[model samples]
Target: MSDIEFPDTLIALERAAWEELQAGRLTVATANAVQDAITQHAEAAGMSRVEVEMALKKAVRHAEG
Candidate 1:
């Protein structure tokens, strides 16, 4: 992963997706499937898991800003 974070839109989309999963509208199996899809996409895009998490944090901060 590069030093750069993910774009705000991506982070927001991820956060919303996560919240929906947590609320159980998305089943655990379905959420895992979605997460896997996201992970695969991120890996293909050259982002590490840590980088993705950092990006999410950065995105949240940016949203507050």
Candidate 2:
């Protein structure tokens, strides 16, 4: 795991998305919106999509565990 720092906004977005998933409120539209927000955040942060996605997966796994 690289020590890449993501913006707080991105972290919050992931947390909210995960919460939505846990609460079974992750509709397709909501998921799409989250993806779009993540992509925009990543771009603004100068991070690649792959990097952001991998980090998000790691965060989700960590949250689940």
Candidate 3:
């Protein structure tokens, strides 16, 4: 489990962006939204961008449903 609690906005943007990526239809706007959200979340949470991103990926992809 991750110690960091990411915001729903960031998670949703990332999830949507990821789906676009898989479809090879990712737009610059979507990618930039995810990037911007990540940076904001990292700054707000006082964690490195990479740490937050990795934790987010694990949370989204590996979390048991």
Candidate 4:
């Protein structure tokens, strides 16, 4: 649903983080790791961190079945 090429590892991390957030188990380390991954992905893709993060979240949280 998105044009962004999200890395599987990044998606996994974000999914895990999302689950943690849902269960109130989110930690600083996990959140930071997701942010780091997003930053790296944005740099590698030559896109802004905001754009990459938005697309990634949509893909992860709002994907169609």
Candidate 5:
């Protein structure tokens, strides 16, 4: 077993979320669907879908890494 410590911060949270997604806690398709939903919500609120997707991709990579 590894005894690695995770950092604490907004980035860390994003990383953790990513790790969960990678660990079969979430499926890639499900993540895409969730991102779609988030995009819809953000669009309704006049936000940027591209930005949201970028963040989502970043988190996903962290989890996958």
Candidate 6:
């Protein structure tokens, strides 16, 4: 993994998504919400939205394994 760092909001949002998934409540809508949150955070932080999205997707996939 790269040394890229995420903003607190993005990290919190990802954590929430993982929690929801663990709780068996991660619906498509919830996943979309997480993505939206990431977008918002990326914009606020002046970070690359694509990078953050990719990182979050990778995180979700890793969590599944």
Best by TM-score: 4
Model 6 C-alpha lDDT per residue in residues 1-65, reported as the tens digit of each score: 43456666666677777888989888887778778887886787688888878787566546453
TM-score of each predicted structure versus truth = 0.42, 0.63, 0.87, 0.96, 0.38, 0.54
Worst ten-residue run, lDDT, model 4? 1-10
Model 3 clash pairs are none
Better of 1 and 2 by TM-score: 2
| By TM-score: ranked, best first | 4, 3, 2, 6, 1, 5
Model 3: per-residue lDDT, tens digit, 1-65? 68888778888998898889889999999999888899889998888999998888888767777
Q: After superposition, how far is residue 59 of candidate 3 from its true place, in Å?
A: 1.5
Best by lDDT: 4
Tens digits of lDDT, candidate 2, 1-65: 54667667666777777788899887776677668877886788898977877787576548554
Q: Against the correct fold, how does model 5 do in TM-score?
A: 0.38
Clashing pairs in 6: none
lDDT of 5 at 26: 62
Report lDDT (CA) for all predictions.
0.59, 0.73, 0.87, 0.95, 0.53, 0.73
The superposed Cα distance between candidate 4 and the true structure at residue 3, in angstroms, equals 0.3
Q: Positional deviation of 24 in candidate 3, in angstroms?
A: 1.1
Q: lDDT by residue for model 5 over 1-65, one digit each (tens)?
A: 11222223333444555777668696666556556565664576576766655665555464553
Q: Write the per-residue lDDT of candidate 4 for residues 4-58, one digit (tens) a residue.
A: 9887999999999999999999999999999999999999989999999999999
Which parts of model 6 have CA positions greater than 4 angstroms off?
Answer: 27-29, 41-50, 57-65
lDDT (Cα) of model 3:
0.87
How do the candidates rank by lDDT, highest first? 4, 3, 6, 2, 1, 5
